[model samples]
Target: MRLSNRNKTPFYSFIYSLAGIILVLWLIAFILEINKFDVLGDKSWVLLFIPTVMLLFLYLSGRPIFEYDSDGEALNFRNCHILFLLSQNNAKDEFPKYKLIKYNVVNVLMFSTLYVYVSSKKSNVVILKYDLTFMTKKEIKDLKFSLNKVVKTNGETSKDDNTVID
Candidate 1:
C-alpha cells in the first residue's frame, strides 16, 4: 500500500523560512565586506565561497526518502537514513523482537553527523547523538503512527497464516 503524502508538521515551514533568511543575510554580509577589504582584492570572489558551499551542502543533504517496503514489511521514514531494513527475527539476544529503525543525518557545516535509532517494544524515547535537525513535532507523530500500523497489520496477518499451518 502507498503511504499518503501528508505533512502535518506546523513548524517545518517556519524552520525553512528561518534558514532562508540566514542564508540571504550571510550572502549580503559577504558582499558588503568584499567592497571594504583590499586584503583579497585580487580574489574578492572568494567572499561568495562560504555561502555557496553551504547551499550546495544543504541541497544534497535535504533530499528526502520517505518510504521502504520489503518481504511483507514496510517503513515510512523522514529526515533519516537513505537506506534501512526491517525484520521480525533477531540473531542476537540483545536485539528486541519488534520494529527497528535506524538512520544517519549528515551535518555538512560542522563536518560531522549522527546516527539515530528506535525500537517499538522498548521505551518510546529515541537514542541519538550529534546536533541534527529533525521533522517537526506533527510529522514525527504521524510517522510513528504509520510505522506502528504497518507492524501491527503484518504481525496479525502472519499469525493468521501460521494457525492454518498447524
Candidate 2:
C-alpha cells in the first residue's frame, strides 16, 4: 500500500489549519499596528518571528505519513524495510534526511491510532513521529509485528543507511 498522510486541502483539517491561519493573521495585524508600516522595530520584528515559527511548526508536525509497499521497486530497495522522512523545506523538491542511519529505535508509543516514534542513536534524542491512520486492524497488527521485528533484529546497528526510494 502507498499512502501519504498529508492533507493537501487543509480546509478539512479544521482546527489545525484554522489555528494556523488565525494566529498568522493576528501576528500580521499586531505587527502592522505596532510598526505602522514605517520601520519594524526590533521587538516588533521578534513578534514577526512568532507566526513564522508557528507556521513552520504546523507544516512540520501537521501531516505525518506512512507509506508501505511490499514491492520495493518504487522505494528503490527490493527486500529490506527502511524508515525515512521526506521534508518540504525546499521550494522545488522534498529534502530527505533519513540517511546515515541517524535513527535507532522505532516504538509504538500510543496504541490508539498508533503513534509510531522513531528516535535517533545519539543522546540529544531527535524523534520522528508518525501518526498513522487508514490502516485496518489486521494491517496495524502486521505493521506492529514488522516494526517490532526490525527493532528486535537491528537494535542500533545503523544498517538503515541502505534504505532508499528512487
Candidate 3:
C-alpha cells in the first residue's frame, strides 16, 4: 500500500522540538552572558552550533520514509532505516528487519507504540512510533497484516495461539 499525502507529520511536532531546543540554548547563553562571557566572542557560535545542528538533524529525520517492492518470494524495502530491512535473498533471517511483533500496544495522535520484534540473533535496533508516522492508516494496517503473517509463517513466533493483532 502507498502512504497517503496526509501521512506527513503535523507542524506542531517540528515546532515543539525546535522551540524546546532553542529555548534551552537561549537559557544557557543568557547564563553565560551574566558571567561576562561573550558566547559569540571566540567563534563560540559553535556553542550555538550544537543545538542548530541538532534541529537540522531532527528536521531531516523526523519524516517517515520507505520504498518497497516484492523480491520474488520476499519484500524488498530500500532505506528501511528502522531495520535496514531488505535483501534479494529469501531466507527469513536474511531479509533484514525480522518482525513486526503483531501487537500494537499503543497508538495516539502525537505518537504510537509498536513492539517490533526483530528475529536477528545478532545486533539490535531501536525505533520509536514517530518513525512510522509517515505511513498512511491503510498502509499501516496492510503492513501489520503483511509483516505479521510473513513472520508467523516463518515459525519465528513463540506463542502457541496465533492471536494476530488487528
Candidate 4:
C-alpha cells in the first residue's frame, strides 16, 4: 500500500498562495495609505499581524507532504515540507518489516506526528518520526491499520522463532 498527497498538491498550494497575496495587499495598503483603518488609529500596525498570523496558521496545518509505502519487504516513509526550497526540511526512513516493533500516532491541535520503533542490532530500539498534519481522516485510519497489521505479524513471527521443539 502506498499513500501520498500528490493529488491534493494544488489545493494546498492555492491556500498558501492566498495567504501570501493577502500579506502583500496589506503591506501595499499600509505603505500607500490607500484606506484609513480607523479602528486601529495610532496602532495601525496591528492590522498587519492578521495576515502574518493567517500565514503561520496555514503553514502549521498544511505545510508537510507525507508519503508512506508498505510494498515489498520494507516500510518506507517520507515527509517533505511543501516549501522545501525555503525550509530545506525533509525526513525519509526505510526499514525491514520484520524489525518493526511498534508505532505511535500523536495529534496535537493542528498538527500530527507518527513515531515508529524498530529493533536494532546494537541498540534496543531505533525511533523514526514523520509529520502527519495534512493527512485526511481516511488516510490516518488506513495508516493505523497498516501499522497494526505489521506489528501483529512481527509478534507472531517472534513467537514462532522462540518455540522449542523436542
Per-prediction TM-score to the true structure, in the order listed: 0.37, 0.35, 0.38, 0.88
Best by TM-score: 4
Off by over 4 Å in 4: 33-39
TM-score of 3: 0.38
Model 1 alpha-carbon drift over 4 Å, by segment: 1-37, 41-46, 64-134
RMSD of 1: 11.6
Give a tens-digit lDDT track for model 4, residues 70-137: 99999999887766554565787898999999999999986898989999999999998888888988
lDDT of each: 0.46, 0.42, 0.48, 0.84
Off by over 4 Å in 3: 1-61, 78-106, 112-115, 123-130, 156-166
Whole-structure CA lDDT of model 1: 0.46
Query: Which has the higher lDDT value, candidate number 2 or candidate number 4?
Result: 4
Q: Which one is best on lDDT? A: 4
User: Candidate 2 vs. truth: CA RMSD?
Assistant: 11.9
TM-score of 2: 0.35
How would the candidate models be sorted by TM-score, starting from the highest?
Answer: 4, 3, 1, 2
Give one digit per residue, the lDDT tens place, for model 3 in 22-44.
Answer: 95976688668656787466665
Question: Candidate 2 lDDT, tens digit per residue, 50-135?
Answer: 77776665554423334543233221111111112324321111112232123222234322333333344565443343334333
The RMSD (Cα, Å) of candidate 3 is: 10.4
lDDT computed for candidate 3: 0.48
